[model samples]
Target: MRRITLWLMSTVAAVVLLFSYRTSTMGATAPDTPGVVGAAPGVVPGGPAPGPSAGSSAPPGSTVVNGTVSQTRWGPVQVRVTISGGRITDVVALQVPSGNRRDREINSNAVPALRDAVLRAQSADFDSVSGATVTSDGYRRSLQAALDAAHFGS
Candidate 1:
């Protein structure tokens, strides 16, 4: 009886502590990236902004396609691909989570690696960056969409 009562009390206390815990991001507002304006469709308000206008010139024999915006837990992620000679020549991340210092720091390291991986693989089948799984997943989703739209690697 004593052991059971103690266990029950500990469980109740654990539940209370768990419910009372608060995360730093619980009520935080994610800041937008500079020079980014107008949220894409289905993107969270104040989230990823549009990239260069459609009228922007592309290199000869190269087509630029913007992938569908992917909403991540932290913010939105979007990729733009420049395809030429039936291959992805350039991969640009138009949007990434810049909501906080941590997000910026993480992406600063993760995005470049992610871009390089896609260029080498010629697809979005690369592994996710450690400690930035959410952003990596979002990046892959957007990149795949862009590749599909461009009919790249088909």
Candidate 2:
């Protein structure tokens, strides 16, 4: 009985110590390469953009248009489209549900997939991530807006 108590206490202490060390070291290490992985879209080591260009206009040949900021339960979803020769050459996620870890993870995965899909389809008539329906819906909605603004199809 005494040995059992000792083992339990030791295990608890070890767990506490592990957590303590993790919490202490988490913020100590700085980002090796800023503006890379885990960096917010259009963000650098300095800071985020001054503000979101919610509904910016497009240029003549190459257009840069921001889509609607579709606000979901988690957060807002938006996209920026780059068009060249009336084709979607690039799609950048200007905003996504990033209030929590789950939101970040989901967007990190879903945004890239959506970008590729949209680029391939050449329109917003693409599928969303199966698990992340809300974010996907927002993506589609905003993508459509940007496409409309760019006058891609019409």
The lDDT per prediction is 0.76, 0.68
Candidate 2, residue 85: how far the Cα is off, in Å: 0.8
lDDT of 1: 0.76
lDDT of 2 by residue, 30-129 (tens): 3222232232222111122223433443445566666777766566677777787868887887667665566667778888898899999999999888
TM-score, every prediction: 0.71, 0.61
Rate residue 117 of model 1 by lDDT. 91
Candidate 2 deviant stretches above 4 angstroms: 1-60
lDDT by residue (11-77, candidate 1, tens digit) is: 9999999998866554223437554445343221212324554345566767777788788888888
| Candidate 1: regions farther than 4 A off | 1-31, 39-56
Residue 127 lDDT in model 2? 85
